[model samples]
Target: MCWKKRFWFLWNARLQPPMPDASKGVGHLWNHNALKGYHYFEIKTIRSSNMKRITTLAFFACLILSISCNIYKEKKPSQVHPQLSPLEKYVAAPDTAFRYELRSTLPGKGYTTYVLYLQSQRWLSEKEVKNPLWWHWLTIVVPDEVKGGTGLLYIGEGSRKTELPTAAHPIILQSALATHTITAAVHNVPNQPVEFTDDDFGPRVEDELIAHGWRQYLDGGGTEADSKWLARLPMTKAAVRAMDAVQQFCKEKTQKEVSRFTVIGASKRGWATWTTAIADDRVVAIAPVVIDLLNVVPSFQHHWQAYGFWAPAVSDYVREGIMDRQNTAAYQRLIETVEPYTFRKRLDLPKFLINAASDQFFLPDSWQFYWNGLVGEKHLRYVPNAGHSLSGSDAIESFVAFYHAIVNNEPRPDFDWKTADGNILINTDPQFQPDSIWLWQTANRNARDFRKETIGTTWTRSPVEFSADGKYKLDIEKPAKGYAAFFVELVFVGDGPVPFKFTTGVVVRPEEMPFGDYNTTK
Candidate 1:
């Protein structure tokens, strides 16, 4: 028999079906393997009908066993830490996952000290999800050796609070898993209690920082006088402890050997930011806003006025004397030492100086003076309409934008600035200036145009009609709550036969009272 015929005969025999004669079988039944079940089954009978029955039973048995095995197998649960809650573990991890908070303290001068509060948050990852425990190791250095081995300060979750009207708040760190690390000597200062309130600007900024996933290490617990005295110190042991604390925090938390860090401050704290950056080369960037070096001189003057007994007096103080010259010299020396502007030129680090054009405390000239002395590529942004407090939405937005750009290596967006000379001109016709009318409005209709030195002069009216023959310069004062409309006929300044028609719209600021309440007719 041919090989094909033999194979078919074997397959049919194994299948044990009622086999047809070779003359009757054709196509697939004759040419191909008709009884593949032979691979898994054994023949129990020589009769084709019995063989077919046994093969059918064997196939069903195999199928049932496969299904039973699958049903019997068990799956393993995920291996996450049993000790920690999901939220806590998630916060502790470094992945771009969950947000967390960390707390530390720095030494302060005199019988005063401060607490450093830090908060951070982000999204989670799959690997971190699989193993959800988080470990943060921090190494803190002090001016002197602390008596207890436990220098770490843990702020619990309930400690996070904010005075802002918004809903977001700070996250407080409850505990940190500790590890042994290098010990550095710390200097001790007499501990004095300082109370910082939410009404203060520092706390407000802290709240803002927390909302944006930033951690703040506020050196607290000092009275205003103690803080000023600390500022006077030349590289105080307390300051060194603060820097060391930050360095250790970075090294331990990130598990990276960070040698340098950036420090930023606004308003009065700008002094501290400048001082810290100058005293330590480990500082990578120093940004101070709304600060004027010259203001230090005036600050002393104010200090004397407030507390004359405590103030140091020097005759001809402006020209010479330790009280005046020492501070001036100190200011110059600090600028020279930090070389804040030129630090990048020599050390490849960045320095930024920010101020507001309308800052009440520091003059714009003071900023210009500082900017002029800078040797390296210095960046200066003069925010318009921002005050010394820098509390407005515009100022906060600018600060946030600048901060993320520096810390996260993100791109900064371009901003357009409007100058004082840019007039809010109204042009009735696109082509001709003669066809337009301009009106300047103020908060009060009775208010004078200070720009023109005119008192109680109003320019709030809409021009109703213009005569071709008359020289019209009409001023209409509109109601505080309504829109004012004007119609005017314009001609060339000298005199012209041609006239163009114009209309303008002006909206007054909303009044406090409801219209019905203000109306006598009601």
Candidate 2:
């Protein structure tokens, strides 16, 4: 026993010079120790030392090996982990086939716009899709008075397959100058007019692409190979790569590294904004405009209940039979892969959901289905007298305000609301009292539908005042003959450039489901 103990001391002194602190990880140390331990075990002196010493030495060697292996594993990056979400896996996948070229630069009133042509990536092989190469015209608005390292990314949609870049969007430029932050807008979000097969695919740009990919995946029996071909993969990849492009381009051109971002978009682009935030950590905040159906399954079902028939706006989804197969296991898998609500736990940053009071694609009261399930700081605004397009409305002002607050690290007004008895109750932070409050209400005597096209811009506003208890309450009176929808809008006019507007979830009187449940006409 004394001789064996002496041997252990000599062996330790000779082999282990001094193990590095485990925090830096065991990289080469593991290999060196493993090989040395193996050779040491084969020595004849160890064999003659006796069974007790041999067993002790083997146990000690095993203990050291386990620690070294764990140290190496601890240092591995989370991106390489097997538990990555489908969106994360797709976006993080290495794609060296990417390039960007600065097409032109134009000077604005107080900002400079750079038009860059970006080839994001090749989605699938040419055998699968006609044009796998995804390209876009990106307009980056660098304000003369840039504030911080953070920039605003607007994921916009367009179908123009042109040789020359078109004009920059007025709203994007306005936001850049208003917020005084570096702003960028990426067009052709999915690289439109792509031919999937000999078939026309459809008239729409983004939805048709999504439906086609879903059809292929569903028809192929939901294999792993089929999942990889989802249209959302390239859509999300495009936004992620746009950030990469801007960061690199800004560094090289302006000599200012825009490291952080706040992403905004409307319709399908809004959906991409949510997924992009989940896929990339550089997104400091998000303002998803008018894509309100987050918990997709329940929200759509609620849509069916409100309007006995599916709105014509969603005909693209109906044409591809995507709406009909919403109840299947394959559809659930699809939702898990691409739906933002599936990854709700990951959306902890500030989110400002800018919606329309009468969106053609979604119901005004759709927030009830998914709002409570969301975690972290969130704000909602349903712009009155507007629809899916939000044209001729001031919704952009609210969005710009939200982005400005996030980029400047300014505290936005905090508020919450709920339905009680026959009225909607709103309680705001005492320190952050709003400048004004109004109740936007409308009634539909013929049906439960409140689509902008069906009801027009009939929503009227009435001044609302705080009660004795310091909570603003709006009386939700059920129409004697038909259904009515109402919400309280709080306009917070602070020192920011634009007034931040937010609203309580819209409440519809006579809460009744006219359509019973989701019934597909397919």
Backbone clashes (count) for model 1: 22
Per-model TM against the reference: 0.32, 0.83
With candidate 2 superimposed using the best TM-score fit, by how many Å does residue 91's alpha carbon deviate from the native? 0.6
* lDDT assessment of candidate 1: 0.30
lDDT of 1 by residue, 1-522 (tens): 122222322233333334232223211100000000001123354657688877788677655654542332221101222342222122112222111123334433211122222112111223312212111212233322122222221111111121111111110010111111112211111111111232132322221322111111112222221222221122121233334444444344434233344544455345445544444455555556656443344444433332232211122222122243333333444323222342323433455566654344443334322343454434445443345555442443333333334444443322111111222122232222343333334333442111112212233323334324323344444456433222222322312112212122122222121122111110
- TM value for model 1: 0.32
lDDT of 2 by residue, 1-522 (tens): 122222332233233333232224211100000000001122333546497787787777656754553453344223343577666766755454456677779987888889887767788778767767777777898888887888888887765444445456765787788777788888787677667654664334667777778887877766556776587878888898788778767877998767688898888888999988888777889988899899998888888788877788887777778888888778888888889999999899999999999999999999988898889999999998898989888887788888778877889899878887658887778878888889999999989988889899999998886555558767867889789999988988876788989898889888876777976543
- For residue 127, what is the lDDT in candidate 1? 31
Give lDDT: candidate 1, residue 53.
79
In model 2, how large is the Cα lDDT of residue 423? 81
RMSD score of candidate 1 (Å): 31.7
Report the number of clashing residue pairs per model.
Answer: 22, 0
Question: lDDT per model, in order?
Answer: 0.30, 0.76
Best candidate (score: TM-score): 2
